[model samples]
Target chain A: MTRLLTLACAVFTMTLVGCSESGSGDDTLTVGFSQVGAESGWRTAETESIRSEAEARGIELKFSDAQDKQENQIKALNTFIAQGVDAIILAPKVETGWEPVLKKAKKRGIPVILVDRGVEVEDESLYVTLIASDFIHEGEQAAKWLAEKTGGKANIAELQGTPAASAAIERKQGFEQEIAKHPGMKIIKSQTGDFTRSKGKEVMEAMLKGEGGDEINAVYAHNDDMALGAIQAIEEAGKKPGEDIIIVSIDGVRGAFEAMVAGKLNCTIECNPLLGPMAFDAVEKALAGEEQPKRIVVETTIYDQSIAADVIDSRKY
Target chain B: MPEALKKLLWPLAALGVLLLFNTAMNPAFFSITISDGRLTGSLVDVLDRATPVILLALGMTLVIATAGVDLSVGAVMAMAGSLAAMLLVDMQAHLSAVIVLTLGVCALAGLWNGVLVSIVGIQPIVATLILMVAGRGIAQLMTDGQIIPIDSSPGFAFLGGGTFLGLPFTITLAVSAVVLTIVVIRFTALGLFIESVGGNETASRYAGLSVRGVRLSVYTFTGLCAGLAGLIYASDITAADANYAGLYLELDAILAVVLGGTSLMGGRFYLAGSVVGALIIQTLNTTILMTEINGASVPVEYNLVIKALVVFVVCLLQSETVKQMIMRRRAVHD
Candidate 1:
């Protein structure tokens, strides 16, 4: 009898707590965020930014990690929909296969915000806005800097990312188109580095021994890790990287800053990953029935050796 | 020639054909120069980059010779690299301490898989599959899902990037490890024991051989080789990327073992053959990167397709039945 009475009191106390939570009305917003897995330092930093931002805003956030799988992301979205969340933020792993689940969210009248990467849906109404850095612009920026630094004359060795990836395709296209503007700038040796440091080093080593090895004057890598790897290869080949061969790459990660400070890397185009404030602001506007634009492009910054030492300390990633 | 010597002929011929083709296409492919007191050439790069795969194949050869496979070698690499980076970068441990602790943990990980396979009676594939998935997760946890850079350590970088007598230090490390392994397995009766267990496990057990002990030893040894490889890889890049450090490299190691004429059914391993097989793969990669047509590197899309065709042709050439069919057809035409 005593056990039953204690259980009754516990249940009565939980019910009272639940009643007070709903009694507080809808001022407290609950949002769900589905993140692609922590595949790189940039990705981890993005996730950290979002989580801390949610905490600061006093919003109840339900976060899910997809581990780089589309199916897992879809499952997270369905769960959020079942719970009747006020909003959903998805960092899609790929560009396709999100139409059906996103349509389900639309039926439930919940707004969706796409972050970092977007999905291909036939219905634009499925998502309120997409906030991401422009990859092609990043490539164009690297080319422009290299052209300016080299005075429009250089034989470049290009260290590309993985084959057929969207980033690789767009970056190659952008760099080629921009470099075509200056006839003196030409890519003498180009190969895929697969966006990893080791492969980058190996490819650079091979290309350094190939024809035009001596004539190469500049290096353009799709990411900072590859540029760093190329730096090692260039150093081993008895060439000064930043001085003898101007080097520029995308992804303004912290390691790039260190390399710049050491005078081993020339410049890095910033692919800023801090999107927390913008995502939350968009969420708030959507909640208030305010119309948002179809897309939001985050501004980027280019970092060179001149400011690397000053900016390295404040870099979050 | 003896049977052992004859078995090496196929892989050697394949490697020779590739080198000849590369030389014909690019006259500078064979040229070597001394820069910064280190050898610089396509050939040296091939040997240097083949170090990790060569080491993994050596371990994989022993495991396959025992009629079992360890799918977790790649994951073990990730774990070992992550541990080393954490110890050196985060905990600020000494280089020697970092090496010993990282390899020790990897061996323990292999021992765990052995216990599950030998004692708990789980299939080797399923048992190792558990660690293959969870090991990467454990690695990410150790690094807090960040790529840890181990910079400012010339002593550590020497393992992968330093030069010894104008050749990469990695080549020397891989060669010495392969030689030591060969001596240990061949000079001792361990070779016979492994063959007996894999040839017929119940028969070996009835013949008073400890099957479980042999399996345990092979797995532990493989774990140690993978740890060494992980160190070389992280040293080469000077950073530990948990997600892509040894991604899908287990398949490369297995392919190298099979290409060396070591059957997956497990018996009669060839250490030299595995080394040559790894060279073949690396040479293929170097060739692809060095080749150019119309003033541009071969479209990156054709790379894997060409690799697949070449590997398929080599496998077909290695088969005895196909050889007989070709010989018979030639005889008929004559």
Candidate 2:
């Protein structure tokens, strides 16, 4: 029993030692960041940007990868609050399970900044500023390109992103709003690809079979991964993809441009993911007691086959 | 009625009632069509979507028959695809078909799992869990965490995208696997031995059956199923993203297996029931997406609720007390 107690003490002491090493620093602007993990390329870039930006500004950034779980993110946030960090940044896994944590942060006077994703809190005072791309606008840009390319008439299919994500919800709404204007444009079938390439291909193949390859005038994806997957399904059906069935999607990742250069993808809307520098700028302003808006929209651009080749060299993310 | 039929009656009846209710609500629910020499619409979609789940559940049925469970099938799928992608990187176009390469890699991954469970004497859950966490990481490491695009594999494309006699090739593969599993379980003595081992390992050993061999074979078989599903998955996309392929598929496969009346504690097995369970799950998902409920949303996450409800209903039906109560109530009404 004595040995067992010593062993337990040793383990607990080791954890405390590790925590102190990670948390100790003087003249440090402690910033707690809860990430969604290395789930995608965009997320990795976001992590890198935040790490580098924090380093450059001499801020001690305590980073936590929640591994795509809401409970993990909440635990990390509470840990940060307990440590008494100056500020907190969260990329919420889901929108609803955040009100309680954000409320705790608000009670402690710890300002929260939402990056890349948004939360569904009814209280506007929970978060200081939300730095995210205009998801609906990204959808609108893709739809606008498809409309002009198809002359305001096409039988289209939609490959949506993950269901619970704010990006997917807003993007679908935005695309539907734009497509609703044109009487000739119709979405014959739509399904959630779950922001995954494999599922995108599977759903796209089903859509192709149901609508008939020729009936599908275009394909609109919530992101580049699904669009790329749809391209594969189109080619497998012994039909030309970009020429026979046009494709439009969002996310300005390099994969989209590569597809564009190959003439397999027609258009892609750029949703800038590297928001670390701008996010830090907001953090600085908020720390200085300046009132920041509840919403901050990031800039975006639409790239088609025409500009895809030229812009391929300069595409950062 | 036979004992097996008696065991399966309630779940089948429940599934029928659910289908009947759904068809009543939607006029176009039962509209299945074959147009222009191809199967079109929701039926085709359900078949295509159920392929992976059916494959995994078939393997899982055998694994559960040995009193063991594999929570790593989905991760193994990703790992197998990632390994195949890595192998194809150096191979010339004329060297091998992508389908052959994918199968080879998947087989090797299955073998790895088999060795860990049988030789290392690790708990099946822990053995596969290691692979589950590390497999995706390995896949990411293989592709340098990038999506590897493959556009020129005709054989590969056919596995996922091509149709065999007006049916998707994936469905054909799944059906073939189910049939093969049914043959193994019914025609051969392997099924009886597996049940004996799961029922009581010591008793099976005393009876002179190779219990270790049975356990090893089931794990390997599960791995092979996951591998085949991975191939179909990658072929459908024509690209491999190590991060997202087959994510959370093991959960769905387990759900399908459990829903089919296969006990998590092990001993009897069912292949055909699992196939039907996969279809029921896919149909439930489709119904949720098609139906417009006030203040409710349709997304992958929403499927979790539907899955939970289905599991609850199936479990309730499986309970002898509940079944007897329902029968008594029906008799009184009649």
Candidate 3:
């Protein structure tokens, strides 16, 4: 029994020594990270950013890919709590059923930071902060740019993203609210593109055909992928996309930047998926018990043909 | 109508009716204007978009004829498109090389599905479902989970966007594929073999029919069709978005097959009906989009409801009760 006990003690000491040596410093912070699967390019980018940030900051990240399941995420959180992690970072796939797990984390005094998306929690103190991009503001920026570029006199076709998704709903809401301010700008046709390039192109083709592709003056897609698709549809119709119909969309993916550079897409509002650095900073602050904003809204940029040349090459995603 | 014509009649009529509705809803629906020497209009769009479904339905008709379902066609399309794009863009491969390799990969995927269903005795639905789920994720992995947009040769792009004899290449490809599938299945004993397998698997084995080869070939053909569709779709957007490329299209293919009057129970298949059914589906979708209530587009949410009603009506029209009523009415006339 003593020999086995000694063996266990030696292995535990070796693990502690190994953990102390490879991490940032002698003081290693264990952060249990439950990410909502790498289902999309954005999700993969976000996950990559977090992993790199954790490495750079010398924080131990116990990463769990939930594969877009809340139950899996909850299970990961439970495991993290069982391990008595220093802090927990949750990139929730959905926005509900998080109160119980969060409350459990709270009792253990683990500072939980919500990254990329916000979770539904009745209690105010469940999480330290939600670090996310304002999807609505991104939409508003795209619409505002379109209005300015079109001199507020344009007949638009709106290619809404996936229905009921928080981003899609917010983006659509924001665009509608902003466009409502400009009476000269009207959404002549609208359809859900399901936040994909192919659907965007198909819906845009139908939208253009319905209200006369010539009558339409602008195309507002919720993302760059859809905008790229709409551009193709417009080109197929023998109409100049950027000139005949101004194309403005959100999400500053590399493809969108390339489109803006090629004069196909007129503008793209940035929705940076690289939330890793900011998320970890918030994590560090929260763990330090320092007061942080309840919501750390990431800043975004509006890129048109003018600045696209300068920044297109620098876009990570 | 003759027996063969009767099989083709309903789906063809359904497609025609949908096109008429589209034209009525928007006069521009039927107006195919020459744009840069290519046809551009809603009708053209319907044909272009329906190409993938038509190709998918072609394979589906055979698979369903064998009383087997290949749900992986959609995902196979994603994989095939991804293989083509990634190979072409990353490896600087020739377009023909990309096409050949991609089809090869798709055929391999079908072989795996075939091996599972025929050799392992796994249920068809469950076997294809494996690829239906994992295939897209694998495609995503190949592209590093990004929409791989490639600058390809105009010749490659022509496969999707180019015109052939004043009609879109998609329509040409779909028609030729349909014709070829019909010729291959009808002229040879392949069609008979498939029907036998579907009609009675145990009896087919007892009759000395190569049941395993029939099952394998149908799946392989389905995979090849899916690969061709993936090429077209990838060429359409000039990008391979693994997640969305041919997403949920298996359901559409199956719907087209069912709409064509092919029994899901798997006998007496109609390839022409499946193609027409695909056209009807695309026409219905275009009609819905063209439909406007007082110059405002139909509420996007109600699109499904409208589709459901149309499907319900079509199903009702094909129902036994309706057929009985038609028979009674004919008797009354007599």
Candidate 4:
């Protein structure tokens, strides 16, 4: 009898809390965001964009940093659910083992939105929507730009990112798919740089020497950091990076934009990290009983030297 | 000649066999072509990439000989690289000062480890491990957790990337350092004292040898070597990656020292053997990177497996039991 009374009391209080949280006439919201650790500059930029956007929209945001651990994320999710927040945004570090916690959040009727990354699940209703950059498309854009620039007569040296990342896999696949159409275009060397500027440069140096800098026509890095590193290597080998060796890469950070404008790098395919506006829009739309797309893919632009000067100043990251 | 060859024979033969196998696998492995006034080929690539590991192995040989293991060499490399990059970025643009001061800082780090082991009487593994864990973190603090890239320092980069007399500057640097270290240690009574201390500390103490001093000197030498390597590595990449500057390289350095036929049991050492050991690892890395089955790059999953197998074969060849069996077979035939 005592246990039943406690359960009833807890549910009644939770309902009261929920009532106070969801205001009818007021344009206010409380959102809980669980972010993967800040390991890179791009991640830091994303976190800043979210905080400033939340402030602009006058939403009370509770943030949890997972520090690159799945258990921490699970704990953060449970905490958010227990607090009876209006919504939860999860930038998952991995694809699996999220269903159980998500099920608990679903039981509490708290919607979850995946940002920057996605979770694999059988049930589509677990997440309200996923707002992320299309990695495969980004790879295709890079390849397309390379093909058009080189006129299909390019011997490419690919500096891949961390070997196991989904972005690396999808990017390589998409780039190859596009490259398959061009008879003259070929990837002579593909080495893992492990997604750091130093390794990227180190690997590029080896590639430049082993493959003969004259034999190689271009470098396709999985990210701008690697491209920037490769540019240094090509220059050291006495080859003009933008002219002698066409440089193409992904991730349109401020550094890449500057490199493009400076004529050191030929092109960069954008993997838009500023998903704050879109994520908040999804949250607002979902809360208003409005139907939203299952996946909202953020559109990205390919920047080159021609318009790079104009867009470099406006680039947020 | 045969008697002398037996000391450093196994590792030398193993390196030779590995190189022959590499050449067979890739027909162009030994090919040397000049590109833009510099030697360009996989052979040159190996020498260029071998700089850091070669330096680590040189230091590791002495540490192992002194009956001490410096597991923090890799972390020391990271710390040194971070120091060099941060110093340069903060307007300390003097190349020679940056190199000298950074090496001095690493030497101090080495001195700290030496003090811990020699004075505090801690085990070498445990003593060096404190730095192994904390050193990279210190490096990260120096870099503010970023990969600091520098494009302005052309003179600084020449140490790792430039060619000297149709060969890599790193190769020349490694050879000269090895020669200098060999002369300094072998020509002086220091080498004999170090071997004696490692062979039997109690006896060496009774014989009026400064055992603590020997340990301190070896650890300090290892630190200085790691610092030099860190500079070359940073120069090669034109950046200092605090997180990954010398990740997991200590294990490889230990492996190289062992492969050079130096006894982990302490007493006696061969600097030449360690050089060959470093070359073996560098060649193995290049082989894996260059491996192509039907022009498709070997997947990342198989790279470690292939490398581990090479290590296994080299270790098995150097095993005492295998050596004993070979000797027994030769005696029976005679």
Highest-scoring model, lDDT? 1
Score residue B316 of candidate 1 by CA lDDT: 88
lDDT of 2 by residue, A1-317 (tens): 99999999998787656545545546678899999887667788889889999999999899999978889999999998777788898988877889888998888788999987788889988999889888889888888889999999998888888876778988999999999999989877677888887767766765565323347779999988888878876775567789999999988788899989999999988867778898889888998999888889888878899988998897655
lDDT (CA) per prediction: 0.88, 0.79, 0.86, 0.85
State candidate 4's TM-score: 0.88
**Residue B274 error, candidate 1, Å:** 0.5
Ranking the candidates on lDDT from highest down gives 1, 3, 4, 2
TM-score of 1: 0.94
Query: What tens-digit string does per-residue lDDT give for candidate 4 at B120-229?
Result: 99999999999998999899888766677755788888878777888878889998999999899889988899889879999999999988888998899999999999
When sorted by DockQ, best at the front, the candidate numbers are 1, 3, 4, 2
lDDT of 1 by residue, A1-317 (tens): 99999999998787656544543457888889999898777888888888999999998899999988889999999878777778999999999999999998898788999998888888899999999988888888889998999989999999989999888888888888899999999999889999988888888888887766788889999988899999998888888999998999999888889999999999999877888889999999998999999889887789999999999998877
Sort all candidates by TM-score, best to worst: 1, 3, 4, 2
lDDT of 2 at B18: 67
Q: What DockQ does predicted model 3 obtain?
A: 0.61
Candidate 4: Cα lDDT at B305 = 81
Q: What is the TM-score of chain B alone in each candidate?
A: 0.97, 0.90, 0.96, 0.96
The true-versus-predicted C-alpha distance at residue A90 of model 3, in Å, is 0.9
Better of 1 and 4 by lDDT: 1
- Clashing pairs in model 1? none
Clash totals in order: 0, 0, 0, 1
| Of 2 and 3, the candidate ranking higher by DockQ | 3
Minimal lDDT window, size 10, model 4 chain A: A19-28
CA RMSD (A), model 4? 4.0
Which consecutive 10 residues in model 3 chain B have the weakest lDDT in total? B16-25
Off by over 4 Å in 4: A1-28, A120-125, A205-215, B1-5, B25-27, B33-38, B116-123, B163-166, B202-211, B326-334
Pick out the ten consecutive residues of candidate 2 chain B with the lowest summed lDDT. B290-299
